[model samples]
Target: MAVPSGDQKPESYYVGVDVGTGSVRAALVDQRGTLVAFAEQPINQWEPQFNHHEQSSEDIWAACCVVTKKVVQGIDLNQIRGLGFDATCSLVVLDKQFRPLPVNHEGNSHQNIIMWLDHRAVSQVHRINETKHSVLQYVGGVMSVEMQAPKLLWLKENLRETCWDKAGHFFDLPDFLSWKATGVTARSLCSLVCKWTYLAEEGWDDSFWKKVGLEDLIADNYSKIGNQVLPPGASLGNGLTPEAAKDLGLPAGIAVAASLIDAHAGGLGVIGADVRGYGLACEEQPVTSRLAVICGTSSCHIGISKDPIFVSGVWGPYFSAMVPGFWLNEGGQSVTGKLIDHMVQGHAAFPELQAKATARCQSVYAYLNSHLDLIKKAQPVGFLTVDLHVWPDFHGNRSPLADLTLKGMVTGLKLSQDLDDLAILYLATIQAIAFGTRLIIEAMEAAGHSISTLFLCGGLSKNPLFVQMHADITGMPVVLSQEVESVLVGAAILGACASGDFSSVQEAMARMSKVGKVVFPRHEDKRYYDKKYQVFLKLVEHQKEYAAIMKGD
Candidate 1:
């Protein structure tokens, strides 16, 4: 195992900063991986138009500063040995001196970041996919609008004068954070390989760029995007710069690890564990048999194999993208928790549900879970919405179809707008999302990958109903992480690696990440969900037919 040289004292504490869609969070983590203290501050976002989402890099960094200072408040500065970052795979636009540049028509540099959920690049993504370049093979044979290149293409064609012409650097959001801290221009393999179509073995595919009509990127040997790329755990240059050190309230020259996408960080936090007593069938199997579901605003299904497994519509088969020396195949739903929010908040019964939840001192979701039981009246919850079905592609399908043109669909709705209606619709949406997972699993299994377990983390995993629905629907045990904030711990594991406290990322994962509880599949509910899964598939199929008919095809 190759380790960093010139190790001095043992690592005492490391900080992990996560820049999620809604907020920036920092955790002060001990060497044992326990979160000692944490702080969070919500960042700003803008939607100047439809399908557009933007944020400020400067604002995100300021939030990072506030949270980092709070997390390390009472600790000795010297005890903070290293820091790491993980963020949504958003695009950050910058000019030559590393100043922010606008990514939208408003021309405000403060709104420079194009969030991962932004879909302004749909037309650009369609054009890139039309090229069908060989590089597309690494990205599930389709280019998602969420990825960087399509967004880059959009800048070139739409905002050429104001944004693209003056652009000097384009970064995946995580890389931008690392560069901010360390003054390094290097990119992480995790971001580039997974989102930017940079092959780990072959580097940039100039042909793909040229074919897609963005040949300018290759003109100077890919300098505008990135020329130097490092693996996720590798330490970046000279640690924290004096400016960043003062901003983060830390000592100068502390180690900074190359970062991962937030979902990948969640995967690192929960996927690998010694599952001897977990009552999971996968306990004795190889890690390849376990799938990591990092669920929150969006959900990514991360599966690894000793060799490449090319499941259609799933992004990856990328070498060493997540777990080193193994191949990663990531399937995802573009929206999950966000979808739940959209459905519940848009319902007429939302006010009533909110009032009742507040009266019970419970979350709306928690209140709904209990309400679901009452509505079921001794019947299985899955049977309550027997006639209603949902196709959870409201934010566009991310995997197993990779079709962005698809919209959300719901069937079997009545005229009533009561609380019961809201609860059942929420239940059906969660079930639809779970069925989407089952679809991805079926696709992977069809491609010869044997996955027997589901490992879950992130915000949605805290919901017992969501966890149980996944297990009951998939007929696989769902393992939860002991740490609620596994994504932060995963980022800290990167710091531990850079600090030389562990020999490898695998070692760090084993030591810091552990299983909390296992929700096993209920055999009794299996047949019921099996029938519902058939309806789930049919809903999507019928949706496509409706679109065809509407288009007069």
Candidate 2:
């Protein structure tokens, strides 16, 4: 690792590590939030049952080390002033010796992680929801199976011997990463407020825990989970421990900040873009006027306000989860990018389409976009999805609806096995996902949020059609950051805050992040999208009616 030729300050470089669903990524960023180096290593995931997803703590940490080492390969380690981490809200189970504890039904102790997407806790979630506890208000009056409590309850009921008896600690993935780095077992307020049932104003509701039948956690002073909570971007301990430093190939005692959930990091990365001159509602308005959409395998819509607002089916009013001192309202889609992938790749023409894509040196999505244009010309309306519609809930709805049992739907399918049909289906799928976002936006607005601009990041932001569709559907300007991987940049902002380079998280966000492009809603496409939106609602309504009839409701 060598320093570049310049008189740059020693504290210019900061490191940010993000543990995503499939990979661990590391980035070295400067004071200006400019990424100087980046690296990634895939992590392992295990699916032992239909609704179970698990991973290894050892494998994840190893991948983190590999990526951290690679990103700093040609950089000056001494200049690396601070570090921060962000990760999925997956549950990590460990024993008294800090060894992995089996989270699966089988006795495979090496699979220590219970992924956030695992739905084995559905029954538990339903039971918890049935209680009608006051704490449920903060979580949209319905605790999702994706949250920690349901998953913990599932462990207690199903895998009593392997999980319940042996589990000594339950760390949200971000907190686990921080504990590994600094040897501090304190949980992050971001994770607790957003995922776990910790209320910022009243702290843990002991009654809720007891009623849920897992009083052992409360009896133990909640030590196995989290006894202490710190806000995102707060400095953690003195720095990295000697062992963690050795593993990461970095110097000991460098500052390490408390962590954020991955999607919130993307919110911190893009939501503060300078919109004053952009003539958007977020320009001179409070952060509440802007919504941050982190679109990846899933999508999270984050809005912050100084005062808490309780919106049904939205996952917050969590205090200080993203921006400090702001109450966050989190709405999301369980599947966005993943749904698009499934729709396109699962089609009959996939093989021929993929071959055509490769021959043109294009991504399958890109090739499909081009093919969609050709299909539109063949249609009388010159629009690929004029008669087609899709409900983008292949993995269940996460927000506004919050119905995990609801399945996906497709309308206006013809008996054609042509690539044009596939392309139109793809276009319709993308539009459906965007419309889902609109549904969330409308829900938030009805609950008193005046969101006028959307800050988008992640894989879906790279798709022009997707981005434009979001703009047209939501009827708001979409702002994208200059740095494509704003999640990593957001993590780096925490590092900068920890290093004392910035006095506060807000200052770091303002200094490091900048907006690159803006997409305005297309006025001409308004009527088309509106008509399709009505169809989208009808599809869901019809499905609900069918369910009611079948269930004798």
Candidate 3:
């Protein structure tokens, strides 16, 4: 990647840093959103126990510095105009002196991050749900165990001396990154409204806080969480601090924009792609007709509207959460890529299948897909999933049903431990995950979302079979972004907005994002999937019935 000529001004370059569940990625993007250089460094996560995941704030920041420096090496550091960050909405705990505070019971302060998937606070979440607060309506009327308040309450109850007494600040990871960069403690409304129970319209709900036994946060006037809330693209105080600038190997005063949750950044990156010539509904209709699907370890379905639409079991009605002034309704599958990995790698024939894949210079998944195709060819009629079905809720359902206790269900399993069987299971798993997306879309439409096109990003979008499966299952055209890392591009847009490169996020999105290709549904396969979807629904309905009978309900 070559740097621009010296005549180009310093404000021409922008940096977008994204902190995912396991890595911190940095991209050097131009004013037009072209990525010049990019780097990534893996961060450590500890699963001390089942359902408990944690990370270190000190370590994450160290990685941020390492990757940012690596990405900008040999480039004119002075030409880097602004920086923006997006991160998983994990909870970060720190002491008054900015030392790590233990978010776990073992008193290991280095494990200060309560990961977004951690369910250690399940009991706390249940207790909070009992309060029946009005603020809960925004979060689909049921606060998740994944949210910060429940985790905070759990820490306060179980690790009171180690965490509660010593903890002086609580931050969503995005805000934590910004504070680390600029020494500014203000939080972005994007993180607060989306993760924490900070209502955009009503601000922090004091009555709800008191009801949930977290009134201490309210007592401090919410300073520890965030006293000053700014929009996603607003500039933080006084740009980057001298100390941080030195640490990052950049100039002292580049703008640092308020941040966004990682998935929301993905939404911003693709949601605004030029649909004018694409023949999509967003091309002829309003922006509300498009749904942005950010697929990775998890998947979030983002639908924006002019008015707040409260869809039950969805995550929002969050005002200006993604695009400013438009409400965001976020639905998600807690496991997609993770589920596929579990399904494929956990099989008895995985080692042999992996060996075959290595010999062919193909991924194990690709090998499985090929084997599934062979099996389909052998069948005289019907599809690969003619009998097999999978429920794909190994990590629990995050949307539509909001059922965390739902376990994965697999039907049509044979005692044969052959690679072909593994392939069938793999195909079934893919179809199941796609069906889950369809279920979310159906639920959203039932509640008034006029979704017409599906825009996808992240790791799963690269898979041809997965992309086609989503298109086929949803019966909607799937649009891919020209920039492969749309999440990174989205984060860069924030820096672009803060540097005044664009007048607003809408303009920044329009200029910086572009569509690459479209995957249309296989019209001939509609009946095949429709029948399979019926079996998929029956698997869940049957699971519910069995559970009810066992409980004598």
Candidate 4:
């Protein structure tokens, strides 16, 4: 493809690539962090067996190339100063020749990636947790089936011949992309500190790996995983390799910054913005007062403190995880947007809802929002779900409780199965997610982090009802970033920092990020939600009780 000649292109432009669970997206952002052009392409996934989600590193890189090329189609190549990538904290396996290794028993080498949502390692996670190792403390005092260690142990035990024995290098998806880009073996601190139990100060823990029965990694001085670790936004090697530059349609040797996990990128994209003009409590307070909720397929409630605040069942207190010079605490729901989709789409009235949504040229969610308003007439939307309550852990709880075995529960069912039923269920699910966020907040405060402002971004944040519900339930103003694609912008901020256009990630965030709209909690509705939140707690408690009775407790 020939580069288009435009009238005086900007002095510098950065490209941001985000690989979420479903799709890969690329955005061309200017030096000021404004998105100039964007494109997306879906990545492929395979489920060879139950609870096993896998992808191909080859396919992901190809999708990245396609989106990046399309987004920069008409831009001058010389104007592109740097590039950055952020992906889900999924694990990628490769052999000595940098070839994909089968992560599944099917022996499909193309499906070499173990997805972030995959839970085939539950047995492994349980065994590791039984050890109660000190390294487990960093990951919320208990390792969820999602982290790399559990997955690694599972591979060592189950897929030894198919994967473990053949695998030469292991990579979190973000580090895989950087290695693919610059041929650098260095891993991002963001990935290691948050997901791999790599302490920022002490590096890798040999005893932890040995105790976990994966001492093979320590044999080569941690070469298979990562030896040279760099912080996010730090430039790697000389720059992009000739092959990667060709695939991405960019100049060779352009700056490529160390990457971040997708959610942390969203945190970086919004949390550090100076909110002085927003008239929120955080305006007078510090960045510590703002909590960034990157809500997408899952929701991660990210907050930073000047010092470590240990909140049990919540991940972090990790230094420089999201923002440099701060201790990061992350609480999350394993399912939020995905839960809403599952509940809405599985309803009997979904066909009618889809038809109505298509006829109105609106999304199903948009149609539902309007439908709820019509039903409520003059009443607040929260009132529609007065009798209906949802527990929202269909995919398991990620925070406060940190229990993967806990299943979702829905109370107040009726014989009436219609559009109204679907709408109310939808409303209840969103409220459940909001209450989960509140639980995380209460835990944080109990641990001594004063969070007064809520910052939201991601696909779910685009829904007005979802945003408003979070504000009302939490009783805090929710700040929305001016840029809707804040994850991409966060990746670009890393690029901007690597390009030397900004001094640090903090400076880059404050300069490039801006607050657009603020949703304030309605005090009048506070009493109502306070009561519903109680019911939310009881549903979980009762579910646990039922499980115990069934098991002959």
Candidate 5:
């Protein structure tokens, strides 16, 4: 998306900073959700070991400062009303003096953050699930290894001496950003309710904590974790502090909103977009009919309801997690864009494809899409993958199955190593991700969600192939937000709310987000997609069977 013209100015503006898996992006968004200016910076990520992803809080915050300063560069500082932050729901460690603490055994305090994708807590998550606690119901009957409770347990068990014992605060990355801005220790409901096992209606599940053996969290009245919570967009303790203001190149007393997990911010930006007159069935249905799929490196499918609807192996039913006064159910695919990149870049024909793509001034995937069209002849592009199938759980299945033990599987590999093969393989990976979304939708529908449309944003939504594949495979229309960087818009909405420019988040959502384009499902291709989906299911079943046989029972 292009930045807004310098000549056209809105009455007021909000600054949004989003820290995703690999980069930090900041935008200056006007009241209408147009990004006036934007800047981005890459942050550091380390693989201390396999499945053990680590990032430095210092590095992340520095990136945020750099981008923020750039976005607000020529704008009148007085016109900026508020600031908001959104980040991956990773764990941040700090000591009592509010200093970063080592999260790993190597004792490097700089790398105090455990990233959202880290799987070092697998054993802890399994043990937590084994308890069969009541709180599991809210998390779709099983907790994935990615949640904070399990990660905390892992720290206490394995890094007790270096990390856990000295730790005075455990902040979700979103909360960490807010605290840095306003010096407020309160956590966002989006982070606590969705990531930690905090119930909006009844506070922390002390019994669940005690049952999971992380009862030490209970000792300080949950101070180590968050004791006080605020809804996303609520004004935090006196807006940006003096030091933070100087660092971000913003005013000291501007409003600062409590933050949200990055994907939830994306949900807030797109889920409530005004879709009237779009001829979508969702236009006549309740907002709940729309599922906001935030597709980036990974993908999250967020559905909201007036009443709680429990979907097995999904994530929520958490109140006020994404949308206030609405119960949200989140289903997810752990790796969508990442899986596509892995498949494409690892192929033997990657070098040739890259050279051609660079010459055309297009991304490798874009060139691959063009190549598929060139080779498909009379059939659909998907037909290129008729003999090749990919089960895209290279990084364990995150939803519907909720099983991290599950491994990726592929069928139909050929001896041919050419551009045609690479293009088809790329198509298969995108199709596999779309299939994963279909599985998630099926699970949600079985649990009583009346979903009618999909609202999409983030990196993958920009790809026509990915968007069309999802629309065709899911048999639903995909609505693209007028603002491609809808997550930034969502973050800016938080700031708007906190600035009191909008009375409510719902109101801000309505006023800010707008539908740009709608991609309808191709019913003609439905028959073919249906047959492939069957193969997708059978592939998983056969994988489980293979595991059972390998056990030699």
Candidate 6:
């Protein structure tokens, strides 16, 4: 990558930093949404105990600094117009004076972040769900253990002496990043409304908090969490603080946008792209016709509508959660990429497969896809998973069922532990994830969203097999963004909006997002996938039956 110089007429650019599950990735994206420079740095994650995931705010901030500096290495700092951040909606804790507060009883104060995936709040979530609070209806009728309310409750009950009692600020990670950048404590509506129980139209419900026994939040008027909220692209405070500017190696006072949840940032990046000339039905329809499926460590199916569309188990229909003036319904599969990694890495033939993949200079998944093609011969690769099926709830179902007790199940296993068996198992896992997406789409449509196409981004979208399987199984064309890291583009879109370079977020999205390619569903594979989906549904049915029988229900 060439260093962008100020020698020539300075060009407008935005810096987007994305904090993901396992790493911090930064991109220097031009106003046109092309990623000009990119860098990545891995962040630390600790499983101090099972189901309790924690990270350090200081460590994450350091990782963000590393990537942001690297991406801007050759760029003339003057050319950078704005900075934006998107991160996992993990909970970050700090003292009143703004010092890290330990989320765990024994861990260092640096380990203040309770990761979005942590399930320590399971009991708390169940109790909250039992309340049937009006807020529950906004969050798919069930408050997920993954969300902040339960996590906060868990802290109050279990870590009061160390954390909850002493804590002064509880931030969704995305908001924390913005506050880090601009020294602004206001939270983004994207985080507050989506993850916390802050309703976009009415703000927080005091009764719900008191009912859930976290009324301490109400006493402060929700200031510890967030009292003031702004939309995702709104400018924060005056801009980057001098201290943060020095840390990030960027100009002080550069426009810093109020950020978005990482997945929603991905949604903002690709969902608004001009899809004309793509020969897709979505081109002729309203933007509401397209669903943005941001698939990375997990997958979120976000679709926008003109009004609140109530899907029983799909979170949202929140106003302006992603796109302003649009009601966003977010459906999700809690673990897709992670589950794939678990299955592929845990198999008995994994060692053999790894060696073969390395010799071919390919990712294990790519190599496995090629091997499936080679073995399937004239038959379609999808046929290889005919006897095998996977239920991918290793992290529990996030949508369309809202059930957390569901465990992963695999049917049709032979005694043999061969490479072929491993490849087929990998294929089965991918198909199952696609089936999950299909279920989510059905739920969304049944509620009111007329989704005609899927706009895909995130790491999984790079896999041809994954993209094709989604297209084939969902029977919708998958549109790929010209900028493969659309989440970064989405983050940059926030910067563009903050800079006032565009009138609204919608304009920025239209100008920056571009269609790179389209994968059309293979109609010939329809019957096969339909049958597989039926079997996929049955697998979960049997899982529930088995659970009932064991419980003597």
Model 6 C-alpha lDDT versus the unseen true structure:
0.93
Question: Candidate 3 — which residues are off by over 4 angstroms?
Answer: 1-11, 378-382
Off by over 4 Å in 2: 1-11, 378-382
Report the candidate with higher TM-score, 3 versus 4.
Answer: 4
Model 5 CA deviation exceeding 4 Å by range: 1-10
Candidate 6, residues 1-553: lDDT per residue as tens digits?
Answer: 4454667656799999999998999999998999999999999998899988999999999999999999899777888899999999999999989999998878588899999999999999999999999999999888888999999999999988898888899999999999999889999999999999899999999999999999999876788999999998999889999999999999999999999999999999999998888799988999999999999999999999888888999998699988899999999988998899999999999999999999989999899989999999998899898889999999899999989889899999999999999999999999999999999999888888899999999999999999999999999999999999999999999999999999999999999999999999999999999999999999999999998899994
Candidate with better lDDT, 3 vs 4: 4
Q: What TM-score would candidate 1 get against the native?
A: 0.97
* Model 4 agreement with the true structure over 132-167: per-residue lDDT tens digits: 998888888998898899999988898899889988
lDDT of 4: 0.91
lDDT for 161 in candidate 1 is 93
Preferred candidate (lDDT higher): 1 or 4: 4
Worst 10 residues of 2 by lDDT: 374-383
Model 6 Cα shift for residue 148 (angstroms): 0.4
lDDT of 3 at 318: 95
lDDT of 3 by residue, 1-553 (tens): 4554678644478889999886899999886677888898999999999999999999999999998998889887777778999999999999988888988768888999999999888889989988888888999878878888899899889988878978889999999999998999999999999989887777898888788888898866887788899999899999999999988887888999999999999998898878777666668878889999998888899999999888999988899988999999999988888888888889999999989999999988778767766777655222777888899988778898888888999988788999878877888888899999999999899989999999999888987788889998899999999888889999999988887778999999988888999888887888888999999999999989999999994
For residue 536, model 2's alpha carbon misses the true position, in angstroms, by 0.6
Error of 5 at 461 (Å): 0.6
Q: List, in order, the clash count of every candidate structure.
A: 0, 0, 0, 0, 0, 0
- Better candidate number, 1 or 6, judged by TM-score: 6
For residues 160-182, write the lDDT of model 1, one tens digit per residue.
99999899999999999999999
| Model 4 weakest lDDT span, ten residues long | 1-10
TM-score of 4: 0.98
For candidate 5, the lDDT comes to 0.92
> Which residue pairs show collisions in model 6?
none
lDDT of 6 at 49: 93
Which candidate should be chosen as best, given lDDT against the real structure? Answer: 6
